[model samples]
Target: MSKYKLFLLRHGEGAWNKENRFCSWVDQKLSEDGVKEAQDCGRLLKEQGYKFDLVFTSILSRSIQTAWLVLEAMGQEWVPVVKSWRLNERHYGSLIGLNRAEMAQQHGEEKVKLWRRSYDITPPLIDESHPYFLEIYNDRRYTTCDVPIKDLPRAESLKEVLDRLLPYWNSTVVPEIRNGRTVLISAHGNSCRALLKYLEGISDEDIASVTLPTGIPVLLELDENLKPVKPRQLLGDQAKIQAAIKKVEDQGKAKPST
Candidate 1:
């Protein structure tokens, strides 16, 4: 049991999350409630006696902050944190600031759903002239990485995300897992999906139905072959987790508030 702990956590809610906006790559801070949720997540992991060997998070601040909160609660803030853009929330392209409800209204529910949920369908690209482009595009940290900066991606499908993420997973994460160390990851929704889809071998059609609620820690114990010993388990109240998942699934609806 000591050799197989893998904890995957999505970041707590951001300001845009509360407002129902498409928040990819926007790098917003956690909301007040989000901070509390993250703290609670840390408390839960500490109660479960999770001591991590290493932590990984997206370059985005929200995910990084969640990792910090979780580690602090565990009294293991000293654990090393590795940051990577590969773990970023999927790029929302031209839809970055639009409310999901408005997007569904403009693009129609089905197209919006396909864009949001499909494995390979990329969203409409954001025009470089879109004022937001300069911030992430010109960011020095990403540009200097070994990953080609020109291909940093203005739009990304889940498949594209998985493609980019797998290299890091294979190159970095797999070795640590093979070394029998417990690992923790704090990441975004779509990035977590990429990991889940790969780990569980989920079908593309079925992957569309998957949703990750903010601030829950998902535990997976792998056998020697790296297959899950049992189904993934979510920590915390089951009813609340289900409700949160429902809320996430509802986020793409044309009438999101319904």
Candidate 2:
């Protein structure tokens, strides 16, 4: 049997994504451009003749829509997709749906940076008592009643994401790869990074330097031992990919809106 190939994709842009808001755990729909971008991603993958044995996505619509578009492009539209909350984006706590630049303007760049990048620091929890809570809670496919403003694993630094995500990788993903199934993972920035850390065994400090761009696919080739025989490749226009990643880093510095 041929060695299994793993494909990783981040979701297309969302409304908050366009507004430069922190989406984190908040479930938001894709913007018009985001939808087009997703379709373009599928077309690109289709042109490359990529196919998968199984599909996985975070419960969030951005990830889910991206996966669906990709499968449609691959002509595997009927392939079963498993949605898991464990694969969702890092919850941005009180920062959800808030514009980063405005927040920074009110709060200060240094504090915002700490909230955004610190390994274990969690900002304030989003209030379940807030009017938006029911809409948020009910929209989640995998989250439970246990998921409240405070109770939800509210704030998550990338390190915390790695902690929660790695166990799922070990218990679930590793087995799929070893069993010789071609797996396609549609996930968020940090969750994908967490997977990358496990695959590469990267240092905690170094992972901060890693950035994933939206709508790009990363392909991993592994051996019988499931170790990467080659490094990951970011598909599509190289210049566009780099620019996109830079945009993410820039957005992290934006102030929260008033």
> How many clashes in each structure?
0, 12
* Most accurate candidate by TM-score: 1
In model 1, which regions exceed 4 Å deviation? Answer: 1-3, 256-258
Candidate 2 per-residue C-alpha lDDT over 1-258 given as tens digits, one digit per residue, 9 for 90 to 100: 227688888888888888888887677888888888788888898899876888888878899998888788778887789877788898776687778888877887778777776666767876666545566666645345324533457567777787777777788888987887789999987789878887877786677678887888898887776777888899999999999988887775644443
The Cα error of candidate 2 at residue 68, in Å, is 0.6
As a whole number from 0 to 100, the lDDT of residue 153 in candidate 2 is 70
RMSD of each: 1.7, 3.0
The lDDT of model 1 is: 0.89
Off by over 4 Å in 2: 129-131, 138-151, 254-258
Tell me the lDDT of candidate 2.
Answer: 0.79
- The window of 10 residues in a row where model 1 has the poorest summed lDDT is 249-258
- Candidate 2: lDDT of 66? 88
Model 2 lDDT, residue 159, Cα: 78
What lDDT would each prediction earn against the true structure? 0.89, 0.79
